[model samples]
Target: MRGWGGTGCPGFANLDKAEPLKRGVQCPLANETRVFRISDPETGATCRYAAVPSSHTFSSAQQVCTSCFGGQLASIHNYHTNAEMQFWGGIEIKDTEFWIGGVIDYQNQAVNCHWADGSSWNYAHWQQGYPQHSGHACATFCVTDGLWRSASCAQQMPFVCEF
Candidate 1:
């Protein structure tokens, strides 16, 4: 016997409409230790380090690193250790210049830098007799033609926030 309805398929009119589900916005990785890689625009060098804290003045960067990243800025144990060949250290920021993590030793007029592996500044990466101590005591990373220079930390500039 033939069916009463002209169409053999069942009607979907009785089915309920599929509503779109709303999702909450959230960071992919929250409150977790993660490594971030940053590249220098001028030098074309890439640096990878565990999460970075918010970018702030030299003094503020220290505080944030201590409170957030467990200690001062991170350092590169051996650039060659990582196949990537680059790392970020706890250098300070002043104006548009980057200063080694060290402050005036008082006894000696040398720039001291902090290392993440609990090592002191044995190697130096100054830019032709830098850290001129012009009354400004802050550090910043330079991405321009110059890699790291001394500048007033209070000055605002674009910084790379890791964590």
Candidate 2:
């Protein structure tokens, strides 16, 4: 099994499956550009997310957000923010889950889990009976139930980015 971003997450062994987002030139919105932006009026933090048609490992996704977009992965701090992010991502009730900023510290024996942006881990919407026994867990927001679930960091999936 390969390591995820060389971080020792056994679950991220399938890093080869990860893919980068596609680049292209397309029509822009009238008098403006349409970007996936979600703003929380309460916290005054805005999140910009793009859905990469290609898949990427959790670590790879995080890197792309920081380097390419000048933002870390999107961190869901509260219910409103989570809802807005979901809406911006066009997440549907039956859609598959998408990666977020929450990640388990594999290097630290999975002892700590936190968002990439160092925000308060105050609110979590874990799926009922979650944070599974799965090793080196990474968080994914479920579009189906609008809840968060722990998944293997190695899994290839499109992710969102936030500044």
Candidate 3:
């Protein structure tokens, strides 16, 4: 099942009727720290987006973020942050999906989705009926609906970096 983000678009209105799909894993990096100066002209904030290769899994992508970009996977907090990510990711990746900082808690057998940065996963924009309990232990931000979706951690996809 897919998740929903906006309501004006097709298939976006029926998200409430959709079923929760498999959830992903969100393990924080140890001693991971870095900084960048990718300034957003609109918000006047410094943030950056790094696109991992399509052959990198969500776990490996996190390493890329910590080692190469000096940051972690993008941690979206609100609609504006999500929109900004969607905008820049669309321009950078064009037609590819990317990983974000969301993971599920399999130990508890629940959808305890949390960000890699240790932020609370209070805000969400699932495609429609997603976060299934399938065996997919990773999360990816889909370009089609601009919403978060579940995937196998081993599945390779480009990823975004946040500073």
Candidate 4:
């Protein structure tokens, strides 16, 4: 039940994941890097994620996370995780649009999307009528509505790392 960023998780009142932090308080940060860790007691599954200190395009961000954190871009497998990411880390808010662990290479084949971490692309919260791809495209999540949109893999933006 340790808080992230080694700062005793300022303003965090509990370890319960169901309870979001108080309004106006943000996730723990170490020198302006947003980071947090969550574990499911029932399954003993834990995930630690952070907004990468540097922003880059999708592929570059992937390389950065792999080299620095030994992790991949944070992947959203379900609604709960996505919501937790939004609430606990604000990874997307780190930028107007931030890179997540998703890339779309298959044309209009949402089922074929893959995460950099090699996680199954079981869930997606795409923006309306999105995935209009002609070739390879990457995914970007926006905080406005927590919806994902397709973007060029070469677009520079903030990203998250998870392991």
Candidate 5:
């Protein structure tokens, strides 16, 4: 099934979700790393996102992100981050569908989904009865309903970018 990021606007961001380590900083002990926060640190996303209005095939969209924006498609793992992606598309391309960094794969006749950025697949907000799961398909975000939907890989549409 497709995963939701704001309004179905397809966008991508850099991959590298793991927090980078400082050159000389010692690894923190498990207890030392345990800290409380008002919200998940990933809520705001470490990268920035942009909603491109121009339509493109999925591959083209990805090219644009990597070549022009220096990032790949976005990876959404939380509701808050998904909502943020939606905001960019909704505000800049209201009610438009965009690409996100999601691609469904098949393994042992079962369907699996992942973000192009290679982050953990922990959440999804699919439109009812969606993802069709019949062929090679990609994930898309919709601004009109703010839900995730599946689409053919070659379909031309707007997308989001994170860099």
Candidate 6:
């Protein structure tokens, strides 16, 4: 058999052969059944999602995701690899930048973001002219553009919540 790296075949292995398993269907793995919910209050479309954890800076996104659908801010996963071109999160900034999840680590100091799932802020997608470090605080998602941008969390913008 060939290993994951596709290196040389194992000893006495049938590299070119294909093995077929029994035809009986099998149940999905427990972990694979995990689901996250998302909702759009404007359109009233409730959706179950399986997406990687993302970060955003909009209370409206969280409110819409939770109140309208039934999900909370997205959570971080250690094994996540597929890069999300864009998604929502829970980091907000306005007059005074502060994390919606309850902490203000990103400022003149450095990019310090965190999530409720205990994941570190290693990835982010900021909108044009974002992370503006000049007395700007709070974070949220912009519904018009559907991208994560820095804003006043207290300014009252729509947010996305994860399940």
CA-only RMSD, every prediction? 19.5, 10.7, 14.9, 9.9, 12.6, 17.1
User: TM-score for all predictions?
Assistant: 0.44, 0.68, 0.67, 0.72, 0.69, 0.37
Query: Can you give the lDDT of residue 66 in candidate 6?
Result: 42
> How do the residues 61-150 of candidate 2 rate in per-residue lDDT, one tens digit apiece?
777665444456678778887777666565422237778889765453444678877776878888887777445778988765668888
Q: Return the candidate ranking by TM-score, descending.
A: 4, 5, 2, 3, 1, 6
Candidate number with greatest lDDT: 4
**Every candidate's lDDT:** 0.37, 0.61, 0.61, 0.67, 0.63, 0.35
Query: Which is superior by lDDT, 1 or 4?
Result: 4
What is the model-wide C-alpha lDDT for candidate 3?
A: 0.61
lDDT of 5 by residue, 32-62 (tens): 1111111236543255565666677887777
Query: Of the candidates shown, which would achieve the greatest TM-score relative to the real structure?
Result: 4
Prediction 5 TM-score vs. true: 0.69
Better of 3 and 6 by TM-score: 3
lDDT for 71 in candidate 1 is 38
| TM-score of structure candidate 4 | 0.72
Q: Which tens-of-lDDT digit does each residue in 23-56 have in candidate 3?
A: 3322223222112224445455555455543447
Q: In terms of lDDT, which candidate is stronger, 3 or 4?
A: 4
Candidate 4 clashes between residue pairs 3 or more apart in a chain or in different chains: none
Model 6 C-alpha lDDT per residue in residues 61-139, reported as the tens digit of each score: 4443343223444532221210121232222212212133322346665755555334466555456766654443554
Q: How many Å off is the CA of 32 in candidate 5?
A: 45
Total clashing pairs in model 4: 0
Error of 5 at 67 (Å): 0.8
